[model samples]
Target: MPRTLVIGAGVAGLATAALLAREGHEVTVLEKGTRTGGRAGVLERNGFQFDTGPSWYLMPSVFEHFYNLLGTTTQEQLTLVDLDPAYRVYSEPEPGSAAPHPVDLPRGADRVRQLFEELEPGSGPALDRYIASAKRTTDIAERRFLYNPFKRLNNLAVPEVLAAGPELARLLLTSLERYVERRFSHPVLRQILGYPAVFLGTRPQDAPAMYHLMSALDLDDGVRYPLGGFWEVLASFRRLAEEAGAQIITGAEVTEIVTAPARRRRLGRGPRRVATGVRWRDEHGVVHAEQADHVVSAADLHHTETALLGEADRSYPESWWEKVTSGPGAVLVMLGVRGELPELAHHSLFFTRDWTANFESIFGAHPSVPTPASSYVCRASASEPGLAPEDHENLFVLVPVPADVSLGHGGAEGQGDPAVEQVAQAAIEQIGQWAGIDDFEDRIVLRETIGPADFAGDYNSWRGSVLGQAHTLRQSAMFRPQNTSAKVSGLYYAGGTVAPGIGVPMCLISAELVLKHMRRDYSAGPLRTEPQRTARQSTGSRADGAGD
Candidate 1:
């Protein structure tokens, strides 16, 4: 069997290990963190459990399809429940209103259409047309784009792709904000359609209109949640990877990717090298080196390229990163409230009236953290009651800020740096005011905050970016970083930073792309062959290559 070493224990990392192990490879996964789940981790405090990342679980079909590839079913691994009112949108107070205006977006297509019609009379038809286009674009992306390895330009020029050439070009050329504003005059609706761009690590004005397909996932298909949390989902991935005959070692911090001493020179592209193994340090301050035929890094691409590999072996260097646009850093406030938050739903979005200025403050020429910032609140206990104590609620708040670590990291309340604490306090106040909660601050039994500096220290994130490179038109699709290293053979990348794009579904597709490219299969669709399944042995050890 081919010996393979997979770096990181993130969704993409575990998924890649599972896929490769199933293909008869002797796979071993190395994670820097003590536990599984990179960003989608869990924090337990006073009987309350908080999901530290990836609050919303969108795109059910993608999850289902990936499960099927593992010879399992989504229903078998997860108990998914669709959220009734998909979400509620809360906007900053209008001209004379004392409180913020709230719009409830219910589940189902017809109800969404009706809500649009009610918001802007005679908008039902326009919404229907827009939704149709969104659905078409989403379908096209799944069929001919998301799963593509981009190894062959011919694979992208298929009949279905050629048929939508004009439309595709138009969407690619336009901005998501421009596309939404052109169709909808309602500020709330436009914000609703455009805010998905934030999840892509770019403002709607910077993201290509092709991302409008995100609306189809939330509005048309409806929002759904796993009963437990994303941590549970990660556990499922770990289970699959272990069952597929892969070994996972936690607290193993990879220091360097060792390559052969000599590089073969190419005629014009300069010297090329081949990966030999990796040097890593375990938790107890011990160092060891392991050899493998192949290495796949699922850590932050910038960290993998700059920190792990040498300058000559890097595909994206420090200078290359300087030219790239980073996604917004964020201040994550996890609050364990004393009582139920009846006013807030499972998911709520707080949008500032001056939307453009808000985005500009973060991504423009001069960046500063915005006051009265637009934020997202996820009440996980609303869906999974077991997450909190009997009468309390769990609140996970996200505030987008510039990716500057100078703002500082996070800690327990009043313990973090001044800038980080100030932002967290402001977000709490904003949520209380906008959501119409009178005693919001008083009810906080527990509080924790994570800032850009925390992301940098914990994940070795570049620019302290919460997401990878922003999904600006210049940074997306073929323009984004490819999975393989140009300078080193047998080295590859799989994560939000590389192809297909960010989000859980995209990460899963990225893992598949690594397999596809490794096997030299570049078909622009999900793999169809039965995954080679070998006999399994579940093992995870802190010691190098040792099974427990």
Candidate 2:
């Protein structure tokens, strides 16, 4: 069996370790942080608990599938509470006017249908049809598109599939903005279509129309919150990994990789560099080296290439970093409120007047926060009441910013932590003005902000991007980073930056893709038999005698 080392202890890294361990590989996961969750870490302050990242869980089937792979189920470990009114969307009743206030749309198909009808007469039927079409897209993408690595376009060349043409093609090219515009005339409906792209890390106008199908998964399959907090989900992964015999080494930072040089005595191929081991630092600040046959990096692609890989084996032109690293980043503000705001739901989105202009401000360096910028507010206490003290709440707020250095916002070269706080306060002010929360600031018991610099320093993420590369057409599917390294043999990638795109589900898919590649390359690995445990003869004393 090949010895495998997985870098980063996030969901991607942990998932990879779990799968590899199950495959009978000696797997060790190295994490730089104090714990394994990475951005999905936890924070506790003044009797309040907050899940630093990934507040809401959608697509329960993905979690179910993950659990099933381990011969277990999430139901056995944690309770899954489906969020109602899935989220509230605050959009100006008019495009640019501040006159009409926000509306809280409930979750589920019928509720959404009623919402559409209330907004504009006769729009309900159109919405129903839109949802039907979206469901088809969701089915096709989940069943066919996401499972495979999408290594080549020819993978779709099956004859029967070709006969079922124009479906995926049409969905891929359709823009979400256009779909919403055509479905309902109400401005509220347009705002709802735009919400999905925020998590997708692109504007609706630029996001592929096929992604609107995500609404079916979001509104239909439903949004859920784990019982304790999202961190509880991470804890579940940790338990699964340990139970599967995977070793997780937190606070162990790997610095460099060493590869074996080619030897003329070799039989098969003459002189090829093979990875032999890696050098990492333990908690005591002592450096140590260990040998391993394979290395899977769940870290950022840029960090893996420039930092870990070093001069070992060059992958591509250094210029490739320029393109891959320039994805979206954001300014985040997390707060612990004094008392619960009964008006808020588990998830809420406050949209900007001009979504395109807001992006342009960040991407094109328009210099200020968008006049009516968008903000995402997640109320963790609503679902899991114990996260905070009695009657208190935990708010995880985020405002997406440009990754551009020229924008001169909250980062290393700019105004620093104070700037992040100012911006967050401004966001809270706007949220208050729109949502009618008069005591917004006073409710803040404790608040902290993380900007571009924090992203780079804490997680080593490219330009502080919470999500990896932008999901532009040029960066989607096969065009995205390959799971297996093209230049460095025995090296693989699995995370938000890879195929099937971003989010928790996509990250899980990435881990599966890496395992598939490993299984193909290393034939000596465990056989895919019962998948629970391998049967082997034991070397204990014979049944008749015990050294008598």
Candidate 3:
């Protein structure tokens, strides 16, 4: 069996290792952090458990599909509670108004249609048409694009692509903002439709209309919460990996990827350099080098390229990285409040009247400190009793901020507590008035805030971006970084930073893409006839023209 080394125990890494191990490869996973999940980690403090990242569980079917691949179901391991009244959206009321306009989003399509009709007469049917279009986009993605790596032009010529190519092409040409504005007359409904673009790490005006598929996932399938928190999902990934005979070692920070001159010659030419092993340091400061037939980096792509591999060995240069647009950073405030927040739903969105300002502040050319008029609040304890003590609430507040903002005096190493506190206070005060939670700050028994700097220090995230690279039309699909490295043989990548793009579901798909390429390349021999660099150049041209 080929010995494979996977760096990082994030969802992508764990999934890759498990699948590879099942395929009879000797897999070993190395994680820099002490825990399994990278961004999707959990923070447990004083009887309160908080999911540090990825609070929204939007796509249940994606999770189900992954679990089913392992010959099991997500239901077999964890109880998933589907959230009813999917979420609540609170809009700052007009001048002279006493309360914010609160709109509770119901689960079923008929209920949502009714809610739309109530909000704006004649909008019910409009919403139905919009959702249908979104669903069609989703179908195109799921059938033609999501699974395939798009290595060659032929990969785009599938039967599903042939059937939905025209509609998909038209959707890709439009912007999400334009699509929503054309569909919804009500401001609240427009905000609701455009909100998912934030998770994609781009403003609605900039992101492609193809992203409306996110609304389909929200309205059609519904949002869900795992009983014990998102940590349970990570635990499940770890469990499956271990059961498949993949050994995961946490607190093992990989410093370098060791390469050796490959013995196998291609076309009677000189042997190429191939990744043979990795050097990592243990928790106790002991250094070790483990040899492997292949190396898969599921860590931060920028870190993997610049740090682990030498500068000379990088496929993407500094210039290419500079050109890449990173996703927005977030100010996450986790509060273990002393009492119940009865007015708030399991998921809530406090939207501002001016949605464009919120996007501009974060995704602008020279981003400033975000004075977000909108914020998201997740009251996990509202649905999951195990998350906090009885009569108490566990609140997770997220404010999208400029990824380029400096945390001030303390430097990037600091968790940006002062900055977080300042933002958190403002958000709490605003949300309190909006939700009628008087003395909300006073009820907090514990508070922890994670900022952009924290993301950089913790995960080595580029620009301290929480969602990795933004899925701009130029940066998406084949244009994104390839899973297979052009500079190094036996080196592969799988994560949000690479193709298939961001989100937890994307991470799972990324692993599968990496495995697909690995199998195709390494099936018959040690190397392919075509030079990896040459293939990359050819593919790069196609990628550039792909958007056009």
Candidate 4:
């Protein structure tokens, strides 16, 4: 059996360690913070609890696979309750308009269709058609497109994947805005259908059309919350990981990576020099070191290379680093209230008054403070009262902003106590106006704030970015950081910044891919003199290949 060391105990790191241990590898998960979830950490204050990140559970099938792999089912670990009337959108009635109407986006298809029918008689059928098309695209993408380990565009040699090429191209060019405009006449419906991409760190205009599939996920699967909030989901993972005999060590920061020189033999030439062995620092100032047959780093790629690999290392080129680096950071607010918010649904979106201008401010013009921008306020506990104490509520409010490429207010500086307070007050006020609660401030009995800077300080998220790289087509799939580092022989990557892209499901899939590779390599035994065939060579045609 080989010894394995996994850096970072976030979802990806934990999942990696758990799977490896279950495979009988002596695995150790070292986390910098005192907790395991990192950004998914929970905040508890005055008998109220809040899930700080990933409030909604959309692609539950992914979580189910993870649980089943570990010998437990989703039904046993946590209860996923479907939220009806998923969310409400409060559009500031059109300028100088007499009517005051807010959009109530229901959870399932039948209700959503009825809601659309109420807006425009024929729109219900259009929505159904739109969902059907979206589902078809998602099927291809999930079953085919996403499975390309992303070695290169040519890696997808499967027939079904190639056959779905036109679908991908169509989905790519079709903007959610234009698609929604073609289907719905109501401004609110258009905004609702076009809004989910905000989490992607780009406006709907820049977001690829394929992202509409994400919207379809919400509409088809419906928004769900675990009985104890998203934190409970993490708790379930922690329990399962521990049950699998994985050692989880929190408050263990890896300060340095130690290595030894070795020789690399060429195909026709003599041995070439190379450095090997993995080493890092523990939570205490003192250093600790261990040798491993393999290592997996779920942390930021840049940090892994520069800090761990050091200078003069020739693992990846500068061009690859430039392409897979950090993206936008976010400013988030968590609140606990005295009484329940009656009007607010499980989720709410307040679109910026000027969508185009908002993008300009975040990406182009830049801002000095947290400005009025598109925001998502999620009350997971609102739908599942079991998460909060009697008569109390838990809420998480988030706003995405540019990364701290500069020492700016909206990025790292936004995590400061003063900035957090200002942003919190502003967000509470904005939510009050949107919810039409005149005295909403009076209901707040508890409040806590987190921002991109917190991601940097607590989680070591490069540039304080929560979502890793931007989700543009250029930054996706094989274009994303590879699961296995070509530079470091035993090194691998899993999580938001790597292949298969971000989100809970993607992270879980990434872990599975890593495990699959390990099992394949381990069962095959030592390497042969001849280089193993690439994923492309191994699978000759598209029809008989994996992921097709």
Give the best candidate by lDDT. 1
2 or 4, greater by TM-score: 2
Each candidate: RMSD: 5.3, 7.5, 8.9, 8.0
**Alpha carbon deviation, residue 76, candidate 3 (Å):** 0.8
Query: Using Cα atoms with residue i matched to residue i, what is each candidate's TM-score against the true structure?
Result: 0.95, 0.88, 0.91, 0.87
Each candidate's lDDT (Cα)? 0.88, 0.72, 0.81, 0.69
- Candidate 1: global Cα-lDDT? 0.88
Clashing pairs in 1: none
Better of 1 and 4 by TM-score: 1
Q: Candidate 1: lDDT of 313?
A: 90
lDDT of 1 at 32: 89
Tens-place lDDT per residue, model 1, 347-420, is: 99999999899999999999999866899999989988899999999999999999999999899866898899
Total backbone clashes of candidate 2, pairs 3 or more residues apart or in separate chains = 1
Best-to-worst TM-score order = 1, 3, 2, 4
Candidate 1 stretches with Cα past 4 Å from truth are 261-271, 529-548
Score residue 238 of candidate 3 by CA lDDT: 90
